[model samples]
Target: MTENTVESVRRALDLLRELNRQRVSSVRHLHHATGLPKPTIVRMLDTFAALGYVVNDRRQGGYQVTSLVRSLSAGFHGDPLVVEAARPWAIAFTRKFQWPVAVAVLDRDAVAVRFSTIPDSPVSPFHVTINNRLKLMSRALGRAYIAFCPPNERNLLLRMLAMSDDPEDEAARDRDAALTLLAMVRRAGFADRSATVEPKSSSTIAVPVMLGRKVLATVGVTYFTSAIPKAEAIARYVPLLKEMAKNIQTSVVLLEQGGAPNDGAH
Candidate 1:
Protein backbone atom coordinates (compact mmCIF):
# COMPACT_ATOMS: atom_id res chain seq x y z
CA MET A 1 0.00 0.00 0.00
CA THR A 2 1.05 3.59 -0.59
CA GLU A 3 2.27 5.80 2.23
CA ASN A 4 -0.88 7.87 1.89
CA THR A 5 -3.01 4.76 2.28
CA VAL A 6 -1.11 3.76 5.42
CA GLU A 7 -1.36 7.28 6.77
CA SER A 8 -5.05 7.36 5.96
CA VAL A 9 -5.67 4.19 7.93
CA ARG A 10 -3.74 5.53 10.90
CA ARG A 11 -5.59 8.82 10.74
CA ALA A 12 -8.93 7.09 10.57
CA LEU A 13 -8.12 4.87 13.54
CA ASP A 14 -6.84 7.83 15.54
CA LEU A 15 -10.05 9.70 14.83
CA LEU A 16 -12.15 6.77 15.94
CA ARG A 17 -10.09 6.17 19.07
CA GLU A 18 -10.49 9.83 19.97
CA LEU A 19 -14.24 9.65 19.45
CA ASN A 20 -14.49 6.58 21.62
CA ARG A 21 -12.78 8.51 24.40
CA GLN A 22 -14.64 11.79 24.03
CA ARG A 23 -18.03 10.57 22.70
CA VAL A 24 -18.53 13.58 20.41
CA SER A 25 -16.29 16.20 18.85
CA SER A 26 -15.94 18.78 16.10
CA VAL A 27 -13.16 19.04 13.54
CA ARG A 28 -11.30 21.48 15.79
CA HIS A 29 -11.81 19.25 18.81
CA LEU A 30 -10.51 16.25 16.88
CA HIS A 31 -7.43 18.19 15.85
CA HIS A 32 -6.77 19.06 19.51
CA ALA A 33 -7.35 15.49 20.59
CA THR A 34 -5.28 13.79 17.88
CA GLY A 35 -2.66 16.51 17.43
CA LEU A 36 -3.05 15.98 13.68
CA PRO A 37 -3.03 18.87 11.24
CA LYS A 38 -6.31 20.74 10.66
CA PRO A 39 -6.54 19.68 6.99
CA THR A 40 -5.83 16.05 7.92
CA ILE A 41 -8.48 16.03 10.63
CA VAL A 42 -11.02 17.53 8.25
CA ARG A 43 -10.25 14.91 5.63
CA MET A 44 -10.62 12.13 8.20
CA LEU A 45 -13.97 13.51 9.34
CA ASP A 46 -15.14 13.73 5.73
CA THR A 47 -14.17 10.14 5.06
CA PHE A 48 -15.88 8.94 8.23
CA ALA A 49 -18.99 10.89 7.25
CA ALA A 50 -19.01 9.33 3.80
CA LEU A 51 -18.85 5.86 5.32
CA GLY A 52 -21.85 6.76 7.58
CA TYR A 53 -19.74 6.19 10.69
CA VAL A 54 -19.84 9.82 11.70
CA VAL A 55 -22.82 12.13 11.60
CA ASN A 56 -22.10 15.82 11.07
CA ASP A 57 -24.19 18.54 12.61
CA ARG A 58 -23.87 21.37 10.07
CA ARG A 59 -25.57 23.78 12.42
CA GLN A 60 -23.17 23.13 15.29
CA GLY A 61 -20.23 22.25 13.05
CA GLY A 62 -19.59 19.17 15.22
CA TYR A 63 -19.66 15.43 14.63
CA GLN A 64 -20.87 12.43 16.56
CA VAL A 65 -20.18 8.73 16.22
CA THR A 66 -22.92 6.62 14.68
CA SER A 67 -23.92 3.01 15.13
CA LEU A 68 -22.50 2.14 11.71
CA VAL A 69 -18.96 2.46 13.08
CA ARG A 70 -19.80 -0.06 15.79
CA SER A 71 -21.31 -2.23 13.08
CA LEU A 72 -18.11 -1.99 11.09
CA SER A 73 -16.17 -3.04 14.16
CA ALA A 74 -18.89 -5.34 15.34
CA GLY A 75 -16.49 -8.23 15.83
CA PHE A 76 -13.33 -6.41 16.85
CA HIS A 77 -14.06 -3.20 18.72
CA GLY A 78 -14.86 -5.01 21.96
CA ASP A 79 -17.10 -2.17 22.93
CA PRO A 80 -18.00 -2.53 26.61
CA LEU A 81 -21.68 -2.28 25.84
CA VAL A 82 -21.46 -5.01 23.21
CA VAL A 83 -19.47 -7.31 25.45
CA GLU A 84 -21.67 -6.60 28.46
CA ALA A 85 -24.71 -7.25 26.34
CA ALA A 86 -23.50 -10.46 24.69
CA ARG A 87 -21.58 -12.16 27.52
CA PRO A 88 -24.43 -12.76 29.92
CA TRP A 89 -26.65 -14.20 27.23
CA ALA A 90 -23.82 -16.16 25.63
CA ILE A 91 -22.75 -17.58 28.96
CA ALA A 92 -26.30 -18.50 29.83
CA PHE A 93 -26.75 -20.25 26.50
CA THR A 94 -23.49 -22.10 26.87
CA ARG A 95 -24.33 -23.21 30.37
CA LYS A 96 -27.87 -24.30 29.51
CA PHE A 97 -26.90 -26.13 26.30
CA GLN A 98 -23.73 -27.49 27.94
CA TRP A 99 -21.87 -26.67 24.73
CA PRO A 100 -19.39 -24.09 23.54
CA VAL A 101 -20.97 -20.85 22.29
CA ALA A 102 -19.46 -18.15 20.09
CA VAL A 103 -20.48 -14.84 18.53
CA ALA A 104 -19.06 -13.64 15.21
CA VAL A 105 -19.54 -10.76 12.76
CA LEU A 106 -18.69 -10.43 9.10
CA ASP A 107 -15.36 -8.79 8.27
CA ARG A 108 -14.85 -8.42 4.55
CA ASP A 109 -14.31 -11.93 3.10
CA ALA A 110 -14.27 -13.62 6.50
CA VAL A 111 -16.20 -13.83 9.76
CA ALA A 112 -14.49 -12.58 12.90
CA VAL A 113 -15.06 -14.35 16.22
CA ARG A 114 -15.92 -11.70 18.75
CA PHE A 115 -16.46 -13.74 21.89
CA SER A 116 -16.72 -17.36 22.87
CA THR A 117 -17.42 -19.59 25.83
CA ILE A 118 -16.12 -22.64 24.00
CA PRO A 119 -14.13 -24.88 26.27
CA ASP A 120 -11.23 -26.84 24.91
CA SER A 121 -12.59 -30.01 23.38
CA PRO A 122 -10.52 -32.93 22.16
CA VAL A 123 -13.36 -34.22 20.00
CA SER A 124 -13.96 -30.97 18.13
CA PRO A 125 -11.32 -30.14 15.51
CA PHE A 126 -12.45 -26.66 14.53
CA HIS A 127 -10.68 -23.67 16.02
CA VAL A 128 -11.73 -20.01 15.73
CA THR A 129 -9.79 -16.84 16.52
CA ILE A 130 -11.31 -13.56 17.57
CA ASN A 131 -11.50 -10.90 14.81
CA ASN A 132 -10.30 -13.22 12.08
CA ARG A 133 -11.81 -14.29 8.77
CA LEU A 134 -13.38 -17.78 8.54
CA LYS A 135 -14.64 -17.87 4.97
CA LEU A 136 -17.68 -16.00 3.60
CA MET A 137 -20.06 -18.85 2.77
CA SER A 138 -18.77 -21.83 4.69
CA ARG A 139 -19.69 -21.82 8.38
CA ALA A 140 -23.13 -21.79 9.99
CA LEU A 141 -22.47 -18.37 11.52
CA GLY A 142 -21.39 -16.95 8.15
CA ARG A 143 -24.40 -18.37 6.33
CA ALA A 144 -26.75 -17.23 9.06
CA TYR A 145 -25.44 -13.70 8.58
CA ILE A 146 -25.88 -13.86 4.79
CA ALA A 147 -29.37 -15.22 5.21
CA PHE A 148 -30.48 -12.21 7.25
CA CYS A 149 -28.75 -9.44 5.28
CA PRO A 150 -30.78 -7.14 3.03
CA PRO A 151 -31.62 -8.35 -0.49
CA ASN A 152 -29.24 -5.85 -2.03
CA GLU A 153 -26.32 -7.08 0.04
CA ARG A 154 -27.28 -10.72 -0.37
CA ASN A 155 -27.51 -10.33 -4.16
CA LEU A 156 -24.18 -8.55 -4.30
CA LEU A 157 -22.57 -11.42 -2.37
CA LEU A 158 -24.20 -13.93 -4.72
CA ARG A 159 -22.91 -12.03 -7.74
CA MET A 160 -19.40 -12.12 -6.30
CA LEU A 161 -19.71 -15.85 -5.74
CA ALA A 162 -20.66 -16.37 -9.38
CA MET A 163 -17.55 -14.51 -10.54
CA SER A 164 -15.16 -16.00 -7.98
CA ASP A 165 -12.77 -18.93 -8.11
CA ASP A 166 -13.10 -22.28 -6.40
CA PRO A 167 -10.72 -25.15 -7.07
CA GLU A 168 -13.43 -27.73 -6.49
CA ASP A 169 -16.02 -25.46 -8.10
CA GLU A 170 -17.25 -25.65 -4.56
CA ALA A 171 -18.63 -22.14 -4.70
CA ALA A 172 -20.56 -22.80 -7.88
CA ARG A 173 -21.89 -26.19 -6.79
CA ASP A 174 -22.86 -24.85 -3.39
CA ARG A 175 -24.49 -21.66 -4.65
CA ASP A 176 -27.93 -23.15 -4.43
CA ALA A 177 -26.99 -25.09 -1.33
CA ALA A 178 -25.84 -21.92 0.38
CA LEU A 179 -29.09 -20.21 -0.49
CA THR A 180 -30.97 -23.23 0.81
CA LEU A 181 -29.06 -23.15 4.08
CA LEU A 182 -29.95 -19.52 4.56
CA ALA A 183 -33.62 -20.16 3.77
CA MET A 184 -33.88 -22.99 6.27
CA VAL A 185 -32.17 -20.96 8.97
CA ARG A 186 -34.66 -18.16 8.43
CA ARG A 187 -37.61 -20.48 8.33
CA ALA A 188 -36.60 -22.44 11.38
CA GLY A 189 -35.62 -19.30 13.27
CA PHE A 190 -32.03 -20.54 13.54
CA ALA A 191 -29.33 -22.52 11.75
CA ASP A 192 -29.62 -26.19 12.55
CA ARG A 193 -26.08 -27.48 12.20
CA SER A 194 -23.13 -27.23 9.81
CA ALA A 195 -19.76 -28.93 9.35
CA THR A 196 -19.47 -28.14 5.67
CA VAL A 197 -17.14 -25.21 6.40
CA GLU A 198 -14.87 -26.88 8.90
CA PRO A 199 -14.83 -30.54 8.09
CA LYS A 200 -14.44 -33.15 10.85
CA SER A 201 -16.60 -31.22 13.28
CA SER A 202 -20.06 -32.67 13.84
CA SER A 203 -22.01 -29.39 13.53
CA THR A 204 -22.66 -25.83 14.66
CA ILE A 205 -26.06 -24.32 15.43
CA ALA A 206 -26.37 -20.59 14.80
CA VAL A 207 -28.75 -17.62 15.03
CA PRO A 208 -28.48 -14.19 13.47
CA VAL A 209 -28.04 -10.95 15.45
CA MET A 210 -30.34 -8.55 13.66
CA LEU A 211 -30.11 -4.78 14.11
CA GLY A 212 -33.03 -2.97 12.53
CA ARG A 213 -33.40 -5.80 10.01
CA LYS A 214 -29.69 -5.82 9.21
CA VAL A 215 -27.75 -8.94 10.13
CA LEU A 216 -25.13 -7.54 12.48
CA ALA A 217 -23.66 -10.86 13.52
CA THR A 218 -24.19 -14.55 14.30
CA VAL A 219 -24.04 -16.36 17.60
CA GLY A 220 -23.90 -20.14 17.84
CA VAL A 221 -22.90 -23.20 19.75
CA THR A 222 -20.55 -25.77 18.23
CA TYR A 223 -20.06 -29.39 19.20
CA PHE A 224 -18.43 -32.52 17.86
CA THR A 225 -20.66 -34.98 16.08
CA SER A 226 -18.67 -37.81 17.62
CA ALA A 227 -19.48 -36.38 21.01
CA ILE A 228 -23.12 -35.69 20.21
CA PRO A 229 -25.37 -36.52 17.28
CA LYS A 230 -25.98 -33.63 14.86
CA ALA A 231 -29.72 -33.95 15.35
CA GLU A 232 -29.32 -33.97 19.09
CA ALA A 233 -27.06 -30.90 19.01
CA ILE A 234 -29.53 -28.91 16.95
CA ALA A 235 -32.50 -30.02 18.99
CA ARG A 236 -30.71 -28.94 22.14
CA TYR A 237 -29.12 -25.67 21.07
CA VAL A 238 -31.20 -23.74 18.49
CA PRO A 239 -33.85 -22.38 20.83
CA LEU A 240 -31.33 -21.14 23.39
CA LEU A 241 -29.12 -19.64 20.69
CA LYS A 242 -32.11 -17.81 19.25
CA GLU A 243 -32.89 -16.37 22.64
CA MET A 244 -29.32 -15.11 23.16
CA ALA A 245 -29.36 -13.51 19.71
CA LYS A 246 -32.52 -11.60 20.56
CA ASN A 247 -30.99 -10.30 23.76
CA ILE A 248 -27.88 -9.13 21.91
CA GLN A 249 -30.01 -7.40 19.27
CA THR A 250 -31.90 -5.59 21.99
CA SER A 251 -28.65 -4.34 23.54
CA VAL A 252 -27.36 -3.05 20.22
CA VAL A 253 -30.61 -1.17 19.72
CA LEU A 254 -30.41 0.29 23.20
CA LEU A 255 -26.86 1.47 22.66
CA GLU A 256 -27.85 3.20 19.42
CA GLN A 257 -30.93 4.84 20.84
CA GLY A 258 -29.30 6.01 24.07
CA GLY A 259 -27.53 9.36 24.09
CA ALA A 260 -23.80 9.70 24.69
CA PRO A 261 -23.01 8.86 28.28
CA ASN A 262 -19.37 9.92 28.05
CA ASP A 263 -20.30 13.39 26.88
CA GLY A 264 -17.56 15.56 28.41
CA ALA A 265 -14.74 13.12 27.67
CA HIS A 266 -15.00 13.24 23.87
Candidate 2:
Protein backbone atom coordinates (compact mmCIF):
# COMPACT_ATOMS: atom_id res chain seq x y z
CA MET A 1 0.00 0.00 0.00
CA THR A 2 1.11 3.55 -0.68
CA GLU A 3 2.30 5.44 2.40
CA ASN A 4 -0.27 8.18 1.73
CA THR A 5 -3.21 5.89 1.03
CA VAL A 6 -6.02 5.43 3.56
CA GLU A 7 -8.10 2.27 3.20
CA SER A 8 -10.77 3.58 5.55
CA VAL A 9 -11.27 6.70 3.44
CA ARG A 10 -11.54 4.70 0.22
CA ARG A 11 -14.07 2.31 1.71
CA ALA A 12 -16.06 5.19 3.14
CA LEU A 13 -16.19 6.86 -0.25
CA ASP A 14 -17.26 3.61 -1.86
CA LEU A 15 -20.03 3.28 0.69
CA LEU A 16 -21.08 6.87 0.08
CA ARG A 17 -21.23 6.21 -3.67
CA GLU A 18 -23.51 3.22 -3.17
CA LEU A 19 -25.73 5.32 -0.92
CA ASN A 20 -26.03 7.94 -3.63
CA ARG A 21 -27.06 5.38 -6.25
CA GLN A 22 -30.68 5.22 -5.12
CA ARG A 23 -33.11 7.43 -3.24
CA VAL A 24 -32.84 5.39 -0.05
CA SER A 25 -30.94 2.26 0.85
CA SER A 26 -31.54 -0.38 3.48
CA VAL A 27 -28.51 -1.88 5.19
CA ARG A 28 -29.13 -5.08 3.25
CA HIS A 29 -29.24 -3.14 0.00
CA LEU A 30 -26.07 -1.35 0.96
CA HIS A 31 -24.38 -4.66 1.79
CA HIS A 32 -25.43 -6.18 -1.54
CA ALA A 33 -24.51 -3.08 -3.53
CA THR A 34 -21.10 -2.43 -2.02
CA GLY A 35 -20.21 -5.90 -0.69
CA LEU A 36 -19.16 -4.15 2.49
CA PRO A 37 -19.67 -5.95 5.80
CA LYS A 38 -22.76 -5.01 7.81
CA PRO A 39 -20.76 -3.73 10.77
CA THR A 40 -18.67 -1.57 8.47
CA ILE A 41 -21.79 -0.13 6.88
CA VAL A 42 -23.29 0.60 10.27
CA ARG A 43 -20.13 2.29 11.43
CA MET A 44 -19.89 4.37 8.26
CA LEU A 45 -23.57 5.32 8.25
CA ASP A 46 -23.36 6.30 11.92
CA THR A 47 -20.25 8.30 11.20
CA PHE A 48 -21.94 10.00 8.28
CA ALA A 49 -24.98 10.80 10.47
CA ALA A 50 -22.78 12.28 13.14
CA LEU A 51 -21.13 14.40 10.45
CA GLY A 52 -24.52 15.68 9.23
CA TYR A 53 -24.19 14.14 5.77
CA VAL A 54 -26.78 11.40 6.21
CA VAL A 55 -30.03 10.66 7.99
CA ASN A 56 -31.46 7.36 9.20
CA ASP A 57 -35.22 7.40 9.17
CA ARG A 58 -37.03 4.17 9.82
CA ARG A 59 -40.21 5.46 8.20
CA GLN A 60 -38.24 6.16 5.06
CA GLY A 61 -37.09 2.51 4.96
CA GLY A 62 -33.39 3.27 5.43
CA TYR A 63 -30.55 5.76 5.41
CA GLN A 64 -30.34 8.56 2.87
CA VAL A 65 -27.95 11.36 2.09
CA THR A 66 -28.81 14.68 3.68
CA SER A 67 -28.82 18.02 1.87
CA LEU A 68 -25.53 18.77 3.59
CA VAL A 69 -23.89 16.42 1.10
CA ARG A 70 -24.40 19.15 -1.46
CA SER A 71 -21.40 20.83 0.09
CA LEU A 72 -19.27 18.18 -1.58
CA SER A 73 -20.43 19.41 -4.98
CA ALA A 74 -19.08 22.91 -4.92
CA GLY A 75 -17.53 22.72 -8.38
CA PHE A 76 -19.13 19.50 -9.59
CA HIS A 77 -21.56 20.06 -12.47
CA GLY A 78 -22.99 16.49 -12.69
CA ASP A 79 -23.77 16.99 -16.40
CA PRO A 80 -25.82 20.03 -15.39
CA LEU A 81 -26.27 21.68 -18.79
CA VAL A 82 -27.55 18.55 -20.46
CA VAL A 83 -29.58 17.29 -17.52
CA GLU A 84 -31.13 20.74 -16.90
CA ALA A 85 -32.33 20.91 -20.51
CA ALA A 86 -33.55 17.31 -20.57
CA ARG A 87 -35.59 17.26 -17.34
CA PRO A 88 -38.80 18.91 -18.61
CA TRP A 89 -38.85 17.08 -21.93
CA ALA A 90 -38.26 13.73 -20.28
CA ILE A 91 -40.99 14.39 -17.78
CA ALA A 92 -43.34 15.52 -20.53
CA PHE A 93 -42.72 12.35 -22.50
CA THR A 94 -43.51 10.27 -19.44
CA ARG A 95 -46.64 12.31 -18.72
CA LYS A 96 -47.97 11.82 -22.23
CA PHE A 97 -47.01 8.15 -22.62
CA GLN A 98 -47.39 6.97 -19.02
CA TRP A 99 -44.08 5.17 -19.30
CA PRO A 100 -40.76 6.01 -17.69
CA VAL A 101 -38.06 7.87 -19.61
CA ALA A 102 -34.36 8.18 -18.76
CA VAL A 103 -31.52 10.37 -19.96
CA ALA A 104 -27.95 8.97 -19.99
CA VAL A 105 -24.58 10.45 -20.70
CA LEU A 106 -21.38 8.61 -21.55
CA ASP A 107 -19.31 7.85 -18.45
CA ARG A 108 -16.01 6.34 -19.59
CA ASP A 109 -16.65 2.61 -20.25
CA ALA A 110 -20.44 2.82 -19.89
CA VAL A 111 -23.42 5.15 -19.89
CA ALA A 112 -24.87 6.43 -16.61
CA VAL A 113 -28.48 7.48 -16.10
CA ARG A 114 -28.46 11.09 -14.98
CA PHE A 115 -32.21 11.65 -14.97
CA SER A 116 -35.21 9.33 -14.81
CA THR A 117 -38.97 9.91 -14.80
CA ILE A 118 -39.95 6.76 -12.97
CA PRO A 119 -41.52 8.86 -10.23
CA ASP A 120 -43.57 10.85 -12.73
CA SER A 121 -44.63 7.73 -14.62
CA PRO A 122 -47.73 5.98 -13.39
CA VAL A 123 -46.59 2.75 -15.05
CA SER A 124 -42.94 2.66 -14.15
CA PRO A 125 -41.43 -0.76 -14.76
CA PHE A 126 -38.88 -0.41 -11.98
CA HIS A 127 -39.23 1.29 -8.64
CA VAL A 128 -35.88 3.05 -8.92
CA THR A 129 -32.94 3.26 -11.37
CA ILE A 130 -31.43 6.67 -10.74
CA ASN A 131 -27.63 6.68 -11.15
CA ASN A 132 -27.63 3.19 -12.63
CA ARG A 133 -24.86 2.24 -15.00
CA LEU A 134 -25.63 0.25 -18.13
CA LYS A 135 -23.22 -1.71 -20.27
CA LEU A 136 -22.37 -0.35 -23.72
CA MET A 137 -23.34 -3.45 -25.72
CA SER A 138 -26.54 -4.88 -24.28
CA ARG A 139 -28.38 -1.76 -23.09
CA ALA A 140 -30.49 0.44 -25.35
CA LEU A 141 -29.24 3.74 -23.94
CA GLY A 142 -25.61 2.67 -24.15
CA ARG A 143 -25.96 1.32 -27.67
CA ALA A 144 -27.74 4.46 -28.85
CA TYR A 145 -24.93 6.70 -27.64
CA ILE A 146 -22.15 4.45 -28.96
CA ALA A 147 -23.80 3.79 -32.32
CA PHE A 148 -24.25 7.46 -33.17
CA CYS A 149 -20.99 8.88 -31.87
CA PRO A 150 -18.30 9.91 -34.39
CA PRO A 151 -16.20 7.10 -35.85
CA ASN A 152 -12.98 7.89 -34.03
CA GLU A 153 -14.74 8.04 -30.69
CA ARG A 154 -16.75 4.90 -31.49
CA ASN A 155 -13.58 2.99 -32.31
CA LEU A 156 -11.97 4.04 -29.06
CA LEU A 157 -15.07 3.04 -27.07
CA LEU A 158 -15.26 -0.30 -28.85
CA ARG A 159 -11.64 -1.01 -27.98
CA MET A 160 -12.35 -0.17 -24.39
CA LEU A 161 -15.44 -2.36 -24.38
CA ALA A 162 -13.52 -5.25 -25.85
CA MET A 163 -11.43 -5.29 -22.71
CA SER A 164 -14.33 -5.15 -20.26
CA ASP A 165 -15.00 -8.13 -17.98
CA ASP A 166 -18.73 -7.43 -17.81
CA PRO A 167 -20.66 -10.22 -19.50
CA GLU A 168 -23.10 -7.79 -21.10
CA ASP A 169 -20.23 -6.25 -23.03
CA GLU A 170 -18.82 -9.57 -24.31
CA ALA A 171 -20.17 -8.83 -27.77
CA ALA A 172 -17.28 -6.44 -28.28
CA ARG A 173 -14.90 -9.38 -28.43
CA ASP A 174 -16.61 -10.49 -31.62
CA ARG A 175 -15.73 -7.27 -33.42
CA ASP A 176 -17.64 -7.97 -36.62
CA ALA A 177 -20.87 -8.93 -34.90
CA ALA A 178 -20.70 -5.96 -32.54
CA LEU A 179 -20.12 -3.51 -35.39
CA THR A 180 -22.89 -5.18 -37.38
CA LEU A 181 -25.27 -4.75 -34.46
CA LEU A 182 -24.39 -1.08 -34.18
CA ALA A 183 -24.93 -0.73 -37.93
CA MET A 184 -28.37 -2.24 -37.55
CA VAL A 185 -29.11 0.24 -34.76
CA ARG A 186 -28.01 3.09 -37.01
CA ARG A 187 -30.18 1.79 -39.84
CA ALA A 188 -33.19 1.38 -37.55
CA GLY A 189 -32.57 4.91 -36.15
CA PHE A 190 -32.72 3.62 -32.57
CA ALA A 191 -31.46 0.87 -30.28
CA ASP A 192 -33.20 -1.82 -28.27
CA ARG A 193 -31.95 -3.82 -25.29
CA SER A 194 -30.73 -7.33 -25.99
CA ALA A 195 -33.46 -9.91 -25.54
CA THR A 196 -31.19 -12.10 -23.48
CA VAL A 197 -30.53 -9.63 -20.72
CA GLU A 198 -32.33 -9.48 -17.38
CA PRO A 199 -35.90 -8.21 -16.90
CA LYS A 200 -37.07 -9.93 -20.06
CA SER A 201 -40.57 -8.80 -19.18
CA SER A 202 -39.69 -5.20 -20.17
CA SER A 203 -37.71 -3.39 -22.83
CA THR A 204 -36.22 -0.01 -23.65
CA ILE A 205 -36.05 1.95 -26.90
CA ALA A 206 -33.36 4.61 -27.13
CA VAL A 207 -32.29 7.40 -29.43
CA PRO A 208 -29.28 9.69 -29.35
CA VAL A 209 -29.19 13.44 -28.90
CA MET A 210 -26.89 14.79 -31.57
CA LEU A 211 -25.53 18.15 -32.57
CA GLY A 212 -24.10 17.85 -36.06
CA ARG A 213 -22.15 14.56 -35.96
CA LYS A 214 -21.44 14.43 -32.24
CA VAL A 215 -23.82 12.70 -29.88
CA LEU A 216 -24.37 14.59 -26.64
CA ALA A 217 -26.41 11.99 -24.75
CA THR A 218 -28.98 9.22 -25.16
CA VAL A 219 -32.65 9.11 -24.15
CA GLY A 220 -34.87 6.06 -23.69
CA VAL A 221 -38.30 4.93 -22.51
CA THR A 222 -38.99 1.66 -20.74
CA TYR A 223 -42.21 -0.27 -21.33
CA PHE A 224 -43.70 -3.64 -20.61
CA THR A 225 -43.09 -6.10 -23.44
CA SER A 226 -46.60 -7.51 -23.28
CA ALA A 227 -48.30 -4.12 -23.38
CA ILE A 228 -47.49 -3.63 -27.08
CA PRO A 229 -45.71 -5.23 -29.96
CA LYS A 230 -42.15 -4.07 -30.48
CA ALA A 231 -42.74 -2.82 -33.99
CA GLU A 232 -45.82 -0.85 -33.01
CA ALA A 233 -44.04 0.63 -30.02
CA ILE A 234 -41.15 1.62 -32.25
CA ALA A 235 -43.45 3.24 -34.77
CA ARG A 236 -45.32 5.25 -32.16
CA TYR A 237 -42.62 6.19 -29.65
CA VAL A 238 -39.51 6.68 -31.79
CA PRO A 239 -40.88 9.79 -33.44
CA LEU A 240 -41.76 11.39 -30.14
CA LEU A 241 -38.37 10.47 -28.67
CA LYS A 242 -36.60 11.84 -31.72
CA GLU A 243 -38.58 15.03 -31.42
CA MET A 244 -37.73 15.15 -27.73
CA ALA A 245 -34.08 14.77 -28.60
CA LYS A 246 -34.36 17.68 -31.02
CA ASN A 247 -35.97 19.84 -28.38
CA ILE A 248 -33.26 18.88 -25.90
CA GLN A 249 -30.58 19.78 -28.43
CA THR A 250 -32.12 23.19 -28.95
CA SER A 251 -32.42 23.69 -25.22
CA VAL A 252 -28.75 22.84 -24.74
CA VAL A 253 -27.76 25.50 -27.28
CA LEU A 254 -29.98 28.11 -25.64
CA LEU A 255 -28.76 27.21 -22.15
CA GLU A 256 -25.18 27.56 -23.29
CA GLN A 257 -26.02 30.99 -24.68
CA GLY A 258 -27.46 32.22 -21.34
CA GLY A 259 -31.09 31.81 -22.46
CA ALA A 260 -33.93 29.55 -21.32
CA PRO A 261 -35.60 26.82 -23.35
CA ASN A 262 -37.74 28.44 -26.04
CA ASP A 263 -41.00 27.23 -24.35
CA GLY A 264 -42.26 25.88 -27.67
CA ALA A 265 -41.68 22.23 -26.78
CA HIS A 266 -43.94 19.85 -24.94
lDDT of 1 by residue, 199-227 (tens): 56457777888877788778878777778
Q: Which ranges in model 1 have alpha carbons more than 4 Å from their true place?
A: 1-84, 119-128, 166-169, 172-178, 192-197, 259-266
Q: What TM-score do all the candidates reach, one by one?
A: 0.59, 0.72
In candidate 2, residue 124 scores what lDDT?
59
Global Cα lDDT for candidate 2? 0.89
* Model 1: lDDT of residue 127: 39
Q: For residue 221, what is the lDDT in candidate 1? A: 80
Cα lDDT tens digits for candidate 2, 1-266: 67899999999998987776566779998898888899999999999999999999999789988889889876767575888789999999888899889999998989999888876676653645767899889999999999999989999999999988888989999989989999999999999999879898899999999989988889999999899899999999999999999999998888777765545553
Predictions in order: lDDT: 0.68, 0.89
